[model samples]
Target: MTQTNRVSICHVAVGDLWAGAEVQLKVLLSKLVLRPDLNLSVILFNGGRLSEEIERLGIPVSVFPEDEWGSGKMLFELVRKFQRSDMKIIHTHKYKDTILAAPAAKLCGIPYVVRTVHGLREPFEGLEAFKMSLYESIERTVHRLCVNSIIGVSSQIERRYMAEGAVPRVVCIRNGIDLEKKPIQADRWLTRKELGVDAETCLIGTIGRLTPVKGLSYLLQAVPILLRQRANVRLLIVGDGVIRKDLEAQARDLGIGENVVFLGHREDTLELMQALDIFVLPSLSEGIPMALLEAMAASRAVVASRVGGIPEIVDDGVEGILVEPMDVTRLAESCLRLIDSPETAMKMGEQARKKVVQEFSATAMADRVAGLYKELVTSR
Candidate 1:
């Protein structure tokens, strides 16, 4: 598409923080804003951290206040906003955003309405699960009726939704990172001192929101086992969420409180990744975790659950070790193995770094997305 003919994209998001979807949105917008062919605008459900960041990128942000309308009125407001802005494309992230904005896109006569699925629906059990399933069914119907295309961060997520007959026009686009960004400098000694970690300790760290799906409880279970064998081992958790207090209590109850540090949400995650001996992600589910990619990019040997798009990235006994989700014994064993065999771990880290550089660069991902946008706009 030429500069004048390029579509105007209105990216809508409901969240207020830079989580996985938010990070991906930021990366896409930052790149798109610099493209002369495209005009970009961002719409947030409520303005906070993310809106501020979006504005900093020189993209105009429109915020919808919580009390501006009744529960059902927001959709009409969004539709009016899109119409007034004359957006050519409406790209949304998160289920709530897609659900609310899809009809808006249609009503505004937007040519393309794209929704990116960040992860599969969380497994639900019992009455709550039944209710969730019903809601998901309705959302699926809305997606089919209103959205032009669906993008999944992983093939697994795409297949899952496809099996449900929810998304017929689904595509997989693995999340990417900037490999040319400054590498995480190895400052193990200084980081240990600053975090009060013992210089001689073997540290196992995990980074993600403190949510049940993250399966941080499983990591907590593994800590006692590792401490039983190697008393000098420590666990460092980064990121904060609803379950932070609960996880802290779990560590205390498990009697590994002293060895576990809940460093809630650090901006210097890359630097912290460098100071760790091993990076672990024990999530019950995931969709190509950006943290794991950053770990691999930082050359940290990883021990992650063998679920979601993890296997696609970490080859067992090669790039990194993958254990079954919530398998505390195996998770601990993987950590111990890496700690005991420094040579193998270093080799694995090197391989992981090379894999990320060659396969998951930000430029490659952006180019693919740009191509898709062009294809869609031109086809119209």
Candidate 2:
């Protein structure tokens, strides 16, 4: 593509930490960056792990000082930066960055301001709630006027954002992963041996930050009942968090310590995922969980909570099982149901692999995003 034809785009990250949304951004970039028609760059308001990781991946990263966090000077600097960058679209993520960056994108006379809705969460409460409601009313009007389009990672998120009536145009673009779940079986013995689990043990695991929102406590609570039903059932909780010690203690208190393993954060997430008989995500809330997508891609039967954008992928009795969020007994029952029927679980896993290949591919996701950028650019 020639200079005049290439579309320059910038992605303004929502937070410093590299979580699910950030991971999706990286995956999307890996695909989009390779296309000849697009130019990609990521901006970090306060440089953190994400900036470093993306930099390591050979992507251009612009890191600004953290000192300008909540000051008007930050917007001034952003406007100046946007004016100088010559980018056609300024894509912002998360609420804090959206409220700040979208206005700057508009003020700088950028052609498009795209906001990706990971989830439209309440960033305020109580007396702050009253102030936020007033602020939201004004901001929603500003959004309708300034923001060109909004990208929702799932259909559920699109509906939620449209209901809020914030952005004038909203589009649903599901998240995708680079590594697909192939038919080739992973080295189960190697992973089990590394984790010191027997071959006969039924492995169930989840990958996510150890936060209250993840709903891991409910999984620990259900472990005792799961153990009583089948002592061979083993649960592995991956990823690190502040609640690790508390969760470990909870497991011990429940007398299922021996049955549960906290694997912390593992680099071989796909390998770990491939080794599991069942993948579980009991998040109380979510927006098209990357882990669930990875789980489905890994060709493992899933037992995720039927919340947020999960049901969009995991059809009940199709790809995997769905249990209500925070329902420990029901969660346990679902696990036991899968364990009792390995053939059924394997079938669900196969179906999940097909669904991911059919609809949720990194290539398809990148194409959709690229098409959106070209259409919006040309229309202007």
Candidate 3:
């Protein structure tokens, strides 16, 4: 395609947090920016690691810090930008972006407006629940009224909207990572030594925010069970969040503080994965977590909860063990089974890596998304 015929698209999102959505967005933008047939840009609500990383990808990034601007001001600026640019489609990530960008794109007469539902709405309680419900309702109304397509990062997420009788606009586009990126070559022994664990230790690790939705407390609850069976096991919790102190308290309260290490947030996630004998994701809900894919990419055997889009990626006993969410006994049993049979865990790790290479590469995801852009633009 020539420059004149290339489709111009803009992605909008709350990029303040470097979580799964931001990681996926950065990966997608990195890949899409390489396509000559597409012109891509992004609008972020805040500037942080995500904005910095995407800017380095040579993509144009516009930041409208929420602290500095009101919602109406953001929407007005989005409308003006959409009207002035050759941008043919506006794609949004979070609810805030969707509520603002969808209507702005429509008001600007942009032909296509797309939103990717990253995951199910997290569960909340009392006043927070009421606020979340209102926000989600408005988000849904905007999608229904203004958006042209709704993309779900997992098949389960797509099925959910379809089951709810959401318009036939829902589509599934599973998240992927850059499989060809220079592989981490950190020596496992060296990395493990840095973590203060010996060769005899079974280092099981999990990477994600320390939030209730992640169900990390259950993982802590299961540590004692593993400890009784094997004295050489240690649990590593990577990533930090609002509930960090609470989870640390829970671990200490369980009297397994000596065996559990909360590493907080770190930049060397892939390198850290190299040190783990097993990778675990015990989230109560998820949408094909990027960390899980990264772990599999590192060839670490996984023991993850069977929830949301997790089952879509991990086949029971194939790629990894899948236990019911919040089932501490089952969680411990699954981890122990792998600990007892190193060969089985190794085989699963190999299979998991193969699955990621075959089905979930960032290049493949970008191609699929670019195809959708072309289709939407041409149809218009």
Top-scoring candidate (TM-score): 3
On TM-score, who's better, 2 or 3? 3
Clashes of each: 0, 1, 0
Ten contiguous residues minimizing lDDT sum, candidate 1: 64-73
Off by over 4 Å in 1: 1-3, 166-168, 184-186
- The C-alpha stretches of model 3 lying farther than 4 A from their native spots are 166-168
Instruction: List pairs with backbone clashes in candidate 3.
Output: none
Residues 1-380 of candidate 2: C-alpha lDDT, one tens digit per residue: 79777888989875566679888887887888788888788877777778877787677998766565554876777888898987999888866677777888888888898878876553455997798788767667767877888889989889877887767678999988775424556697898888887888999999999988899999998888888778888899989998999999998888888888888887888889888889999988888888888888778899998888888988999999998999999999999999999999999999998898898898899888888888799885
lDDT of 1 by residue, 136-224 (tens): 87788788888877888888987876676655467878888877566656577888789888767888998888989999999999999
lDDT (10s digit) by residue, model 3, range 235-298 = 9999999999998899889999899999999999988998999998989889979999999998
Ranking by lDDT: 3, 1, 2
Q: Which candidate wins on lDDT? A: 3
Residue 127 in model 1: lDDT: 98
lDDT of each: 0.85, 0.84, 0.91
